[model samples]
Target chain A: MARIDLVDLAHAYRPNPTTDADYALRPMNTSWRQGGAYALLGPSGCGKTTLLNIISGLVVPSRGHVLFDGVDVTRLATEKRNIAQVFQFPVIYDTMTVRENLAFPLRNRGMPAAAVAARVGEIAELLDLNVDLDRRARALTPDAKQKISLGRGLVRSDVAAILFDEPLTVIDPALKWELRSKLKALHRALDLTMIYVTHDQTEALTFADTVVVMHDGAIVQMGRPNELFERPEHTFVGHFIGSPGMNVLPAKVEGRTADVGGVPIALGRSYSAIPPGRKIEIGIRPEYVRLSSGEGVPVRVERIDDLGRIRFAKVRLGDARLSVVAPPGVRLEDDRSRVSFDPAQIHVYADSRRIEGDA
Target chain B: MDKPINNAAWFLILPAFAIVLFNAVIPMMTVVNYSVQDSFGNNQFFWNGLGWFQELLDPSSELGGRFFASLGRSALFSAIVLAVQVPLGIAVALSMPRSGIALALCLVFIAMPLLIPWNVVGTMWQLYSRSDIGLLGWTVNAIGIPFNYTNSVLAAWTVLVLMDTWHWTGLIALLCYAGLKSIPDAYYQAARIDGASRWAVFTRIELPKLRSVLLIGVLLRFMDSFMIYTEPFVVTGGGPGSVTTFLSIDLVKIALGQFDLGKAGAMSIVYTLIILAVCWVFYTVMVTPENKGARE
Candidate 1:
């Protein structure tokens, strides 16, 4: 695995950036290991694509360096970066046949003709495009064109890394899973360094080994997919990376006891540092909260949505509307219900920053 | 994509058909009528079946020499215009900025000459090429050379070719620009990844994609140059022993100036047929079966 280091990389499209707020990508340092499949996940207008472009050398960083294998490539053009990129839309040459589209890069690099054909043959088969090798790219469906685009990047086995920029955004939803699975399989088989950028959490979680969560222009957190799901370091990370997102409630804290909406909540684990502050908020995933017939915080259940596999209890705890996921076997009770949460599953925050003290 | 064919489609299409009939088909029919019948005065007419067509096609007649010479001249003029314009337009389009105010500025400047009325373009060049008052002719005359376009075959051809280029190159450039603009940023990305040179990117990604527009541009330029008039008439008046006389000039000379309506009509039909035939050949050869739906 090659080590990629970004040393204080910052970018601003404007001529003069007067402050950190002016930067489109806030200056930061981070490294991704070689052979790691990492996803940069964030909403639109966030710096995920910007960061991906920076790494791919499509955009020169306004400040600092991008080191690949400990060599600075910050000033290098994208052509010299040796990185493959799949764009949001399929970019295969429409005039070329499916095989020609896949073989273009290899032929450009002066690969032997036999080898180019052999590799194109392999990639086409992997993408299930073998039968259409002789068919012109123009005659294919949108998904087929995308497969050619994918194969064009992957056909060159010598690329240092593959950078995917929302490659599946144009795909129909039904085909998204099939393509994602193909990408995941390709990554496993090739063991190439791949960096994917997407706003969809399911895509990010399914394809990448490590997930990098970004907000505004800065990276909020980076960890394994399960690590991100289980223990998000930043409040934005928890909120941005999950379905229905994590429910955040304003809270107050002192010593061992955490008061959320002026109701006492227990913490099973202790922390060395939770700074007492104003603007504190409590974060919890909707699936983590439990609604049972046991004694706990009293709440009035306003609505229950019974989805096929689970039920969502939209409960009123004081002025807050909170939802708890019930497993398939349990039926949610009346308007008045008691809601309880696993104390160890709790993550408390103060002033938008996660409290380090008690879980 | 399927729709049932209905007679109601004719109701929707009738106005369009009427417009074409009024504007194009009727004029063509008039040319056909004149081709067969002789016109003596405003009211008198006589049937001269194939009489003028025979004379125009005969090597012994002056009409034959003029017809052949004009055909050769028109072909050469069209060839030179295409050779000069398409590449020049593509180059200008390539060199322009891709976005922002700079792109708008380039577009406005390129579009400036195309907006000038055709006859105004002819008039402008007419004045600009005069030995007495025109700057270019005056400068040439001061350099100790006679620079009268009305009398010099070289000067006449230069003025006509340059004027046509100046007036119409913008159209080609705009068309090529549209073709260039429609290319997704992705192909460039793929090229960049492929380590393609600038020339390679242009040839492999840009030019092949521009094939359809190039086809249109060439056909359009050919049709326009072959039928060209007005500008040459204003500037050279087909002088200097008819060195710059294209077929349209001779057609106008025959029908209107000499009142040889039958021969002129026959020549006009022949000229139109020649233009249609050449353009059809170009279109078929350049853009037929192989490249149909070549681009998605």
Candidate 2:
């Protein structure tokens, strides 16, 4: 397997892209360490799939090079690049038997028949497709067909990487977890470099060792799932990584104290270098915002959503709405309430970029 | 427990029943009646139950031999047309532009042949194959080949087959094109990732996906060409000693030209049964699991 590198990769669907808006993938450089499971997580049309396609050689980047273990393969066709990819939908060969479907990739490369059959048998057993090996692919259910798609990719032993483009979108909800755990198991067993693209945060967080959070066409942060959750380098990552997301309140910062809305709050870290004209905001995850009795920002509780284990209280301070997690049986009786933020959990952002501060 | 029945639903089906009665049932019954009886002048009829069918099926009889010979010709014509049209149609469909203004233009031009009426097509080919004045005949003659559709059996058969091909290959190609368009882009991408060659992609992915539509095309072509009468009738008129006369033309010649209604009716029933049997066999074979599983 090869360590993949994207050097200054940028792609545009249209010819002659002169601005960032015209590019599907804005200029950026990133690399995937050998044998690491990474997830490119983003909202729809954020160019995660474009980046995956570039890596798979399905689409050439408009202005960058893709190197596999330091070899420039920018102009190589997908067949020559030795990559495997599973698409968003199940794409099994409808006419072939399940066994033959698994053997297709190896046979296409002119592998010996015995080797192909052995590989097919191995992948079929791994995917629980042994009994249905002789069945027509069209007759199986969607999940089974998707398993065949995975099997086809896994059948090839020498592929540099296997890229997945939202492969579980069509799976049943209950089976999604089973297949995801199976994928994680397969990663551990085979130790193949894998890159999964998805918009669902849970899928990204649970499957990837490192999650690359993207917005608009550029990566906002790339770190371990917990790092992305704890210390988001961009406001987009802070707002996108968690359940109910992070609450961002506009702030006026000077030295170590800040005024949020109308109340002056003590800063946990210094933001003295932040200029006066720049827009400054304080970000805190919903998990860290707590209800207080005496000292905190005054808020009007609007609604409380009970989520079985934890509840989210929607509160408003001035015109901004913020979510605070309340324990199982907390009551919100009065219209006015006080909520406090943990100093270590607070993040400062100026112009959507996380400003440097002491943790 | 007795179930409550809604008799009013019967009223809703009355229109369809009446249409079928006038369109299909009446003519079928009349044909059955004609097949079982002999008719003379002045509305006089005699009961001849099974006599015409017996004569038509008996190979030793003159009418039976004629019927068998014409049926063989019809089968051969259909086989040749299908063999030529299906592959050619698939190739043309594969070469067609996928999108943009060129796709629309290609579709319109390909559909032009199918839009021409059957009789008009027949008459056009009749004049177009004239050895003295027609472009094709004159060109062949200029190239040192004596081609006269009126006098040579080979020339007449070629013109007949060529005319039919030109008239109907477009329909098959259009059906195949629709099938090709329905396949998603993901299949091609997956094939590319799997390192499949161009031929592998076509045989494994494109051809298999086109199976159902190709079945439809084959069935339609077989049945239509088996009963073909119009174009050949107008252009060749079973010329050069009946070499190009197909089943429908022979049936017409027997019933209308020779006034043998009972025999013709029997032949017509037999022809329809043959077509139905072949179509059923084709449909079953095309959709069976064995055929699907046989691919690798």
Candidate 3:
């Protein structure tokens, strides 16, 4: 396993990109620790695939260098870079049996036949594919074929890293969980650096130790799953993560309090200097916002969504819509209610970037 | 839910049935009638009682000897062309550009030969391989190869095979190119990341994906070459001691040149049965679920 360092890496499909909008992946510096389970999480066309491709050496960056274990491998071809990738769809050799498919990468590198067989057996057992070792890859189900695709990468012992570009896209819904758990188990057994790219928050949150959230063409936040949940680094991350996502409302902030549509709310931290002419906002998770009897900012309850375990009220605070947790047995008077935000959970954003405040 | 049954839907197939009957059934019945009877001048006929069939099956008889010889020649010609063209076509397909104006131009050039009319292809090859005036024949003779397609059996077979290859290999190449186009870019990327060599990638990824198209190419080429008549007939004229006279040419000679209606009709039926049987075997072997599952 090797630590992957992206030194100011950026890429654009066209030559001579003159603006940030032209780049598929904007310039950024990041390092993935060896054996770390990381997820590159983003929506479609957000450049997650472009960044993954750059890491796997499928696409060379337009600027900067990719270093593996401190060795610069910016221009190295995919085969020379010693990385493995599983695609959005299962890409198995159709004519080969499961055992042969697993052994392919090893055989391609001229590994000894005995060693290849041993590794293939280990991978098949790990993937729970021992019963299908002799079956043709084309005859298996999609999930089984996807396991074979994963096995091909895992069979190579010297592989530096493994990249997955939404590998579970084609799997059945029931099998997605089973396969995901199997991947988690595999990660525990084999301490290889794995980069999983996906748009699903649940997949990213559960599968990754660290979720690198990308927005537009750049990484907005990279932190532990809980860190992302408790404190999203940017407004995009706050809006993108969680079920209802973080409720962001335009506000005016002064010293120790913020006014949301002219209603003052307490702030846990105090700001000394407010940036001039910047759009100010406050982000709070729906879990932190609660419906109160009469003590907090008044809102109109638009609708109550019962998610079986807990209820959430979609409420309107002045002109801004907000989602707040509705306590069981709490009745609203004519759909007019008040919601209180846990001041510690409140994060202030200045022009979409999180701004730190002092106590 | 119970479904309603309508007999009126059956009428939709009448036009197709009529077309098949007029094109296939009526002509086949006429041949069957001729096969069972002897015909003389002025359409005079006498019942032969399968005498032509009996004579045609016996190797010592003139009709049987000529029929078996031509059948063997046709089979050999089919084998030779298929063996040469399939590999050459695959190579040509692999070398073709993936996309751009160059790729479009390349496809157009590759498809040019297939668009030519059969008679034109035949006439063109006939003149193209003349030893005295043609580019190919004159070049070979100038290189001290002593090639004369009109008098030499070897030269006649060579020109016939070359002409057939040139006229049809493009069909196989285009089919293979289409198959190649359907393969996703992810397969190649996966293969590369798996440390696969160029040859390994072609064999393990590309060749397997091209299997269905290759089957079509092989089937079409085999059938076309087996029943080949126009090009070879025009160029070799089944001459040079009857070496290049295939089954179709022999059947034409018996039916038209010698006017032996009974023998020619019987031969025609047998030739058609052979082609049908071969096609059945090909379809069954290549497309059966068991075979498809095993191969794919």
Candidate 4:
């Protein structure tokens, strides 16, 4: 096991990249500690897979070095780097039996035949592939094939890390949950450094202790799951993490008060000397917004979605349309509605970035 | 309650059936009819019954021994062609460029020989292998080896095999290249991650994926070689004293050269049955259990 560090890493598919747009992954520095489970979450084309490939040594960054345990391995090939990766599609040796498929990596690394067999047996049992061990990998279901892919990675004891690139995408929906929980359990049992790349928020939130949210070739935030939902550092994270996401409203701030449309609201903390051209907005989660009577901004209730546990009220306050999650027992006054933001849940942003100290 | 059976669905197959009947069935039926009887001029066919078949099967008979000799020769030619071409084609395909202008150039070059007419290929090789004027023959002789394809049986056989390989190996290579290209890059990436050696990657991943396409290559080459005629017939003309007379050339000689229609027809029927049985056996053996689903 090793700690993977990306030092000022950036990549471009083109030979000569003169502009930021030419780069697939923007320059950034981050380190994944040994034995930590991390998720790199982003939308499509957000460079999450590029980052994973860089860490796995499948890709060499144009401008920075990848260090594993402080050893420069930027130019090392994947085999020499000793990293294992499970692709989106299950990649198994179709001609080989499941036992051979699981034993491949071990044998490739020059392990003894007896040890390879023992390790293959252990992993096959762990993956519930014991019964199909003698069958050809091509005849198995997709989920079973994926389990062989996982077992191939797991069988190698000296692997630096295991990387998963949307490995559950091809699995049946019912089996996705089971595979994900099994993966989480494996991480806990093995305590290997695993970096999972995915676009699904639920998968990331459920699997990783730390979620790294990326946007437009750069990481926007890196925090615990709850931290990302409650205190998103960027507007992209605020809008991406939650089910309906956090609602961001334009506001003008001066001193300790901010104007939401025409109505002035008191800030949770005082601010001094505000800049003129910087964009300012206040964000509140739908779960934290409440129906108010006397204070808060006035809104008109547009629609209400009655989910089993929570009722989501879609309300409009002037030019901004917002969604407020209300409990099943709470009723919204249909025509004229006022929603209040919780002081602790109210997050302020300037120019799309959270105003850390000001908040 | 029984659902109505639409007999119209059976009629939907008529066009394909009609095409097959006009192209294959009629010609095959004529051969079968000729096989069972003797035709003496004036379109009069005498009921020979199994007379021609019995003669062809008896080893002591002239036609029987000649037919067996040519059949064995044809089998050997096909075996040699397959042995050389399959591996050679796979090697070329593996080394071919993956993309860019180089790949386009390679594809165009490989397809050139296959596009040439069969008779043209024959005539070209006939002149090309002449020791007096041909570059190949003159060079080999100039190197102090007495080489004359028309005179020596070994040289004739070698020239025939070489010419066939030159003409058709490209087809096999092209098919294999296409199969290799269809494989996604992820498989290779995963193999690299698993620390598989180059040989392991080829045997475990690439070879397995290529099984179906290679079977096609084998089937095409096998049938073409088994029925080979025009190229060798034009170049050697069954010359060098019957040394290069394959089954098809022998059949043509009997049917046209000697006008022995009954014997030629019998030989043709046996040849067709042999080819069909071999191809069916190969196709069945090569297809994996999992691939059965894809075939359906």
Question: Candidate 4 clash total?
Answer: 0
Please list all clashing residue pairs in model 4, or write none if there are none. Answer: none
Q: After superposing candidate 2, which stretches have Cα over 4 Å from the reference?
A: B1-3, B290-296
**Per-residue lDDT of model 3, residues A1-359, tens digit only:** 89999999899999999999999999999999999999999899999999999999999999999999999999999998999999999999987889999998888888999988888999999999999999888898899999999998888878889999999999999999999999999999999999999999999999999999999889999999999999998999998999889999999999889999888888889976988899999999999988876778778888888999989888898899998888986654546578888999999999999999998
Residue A103 lDDT, candidate 2, scale 0-100 = 91
Q: Write the per-residue lDDT of candidate 1 for residues A134-225, one digit (tens) a residue.
A: 98887888888888888988888877788899999889999999999999999999988899999999999989989988888998888898
Reference-based lDDT, residue A90, model 1: 85
Docking class of 4: medium
Candidate 2 or 1, higher TM-score = 2
The true-versus-predicted C-alpha distance at residue B134 of model 2, in Å, is: 0.3
Better of 1 and 2 by lDDT: 2
Give the chain B TM-score achieved by candidate 2. Answer: 0.95
Model 1 deviation from native, Cα RMSD in Å: 3.1
Which 10-residue span in candidate 1 chain A carries the lowest summed lDDT? A327-336
Pick the TM-score winner.
Answer: 2
Per-model TM-score of chain A alone? 0.94, 0.97, 0.98, 0.96
Tell me the tens digit of each residue's lDDT in model 2 across A196-311: 99999999999999999999999999999999999989888988899889888898887677778777767688776776787899888999888755568788878899887778
Q: Which stretches of candidate 4 lie over 4 Å from their true place?
A: A292-295, A329-333, B6-19, B288-296
Per-residue alpha-carbon lDDT of model 4 for B2-68, expressed as tens digits?
A: 9998898999999999999999999999888899888777778888888888988887899999988
* lDDT winner: 3
Flag the better candidate by DockQ, 2 or 3: 3
Q: In candidate 3, which residue ranges exceed 4 Å CA deviation?
A: A330-333, B1-12, B288-296
Clashing pairs in 3: none
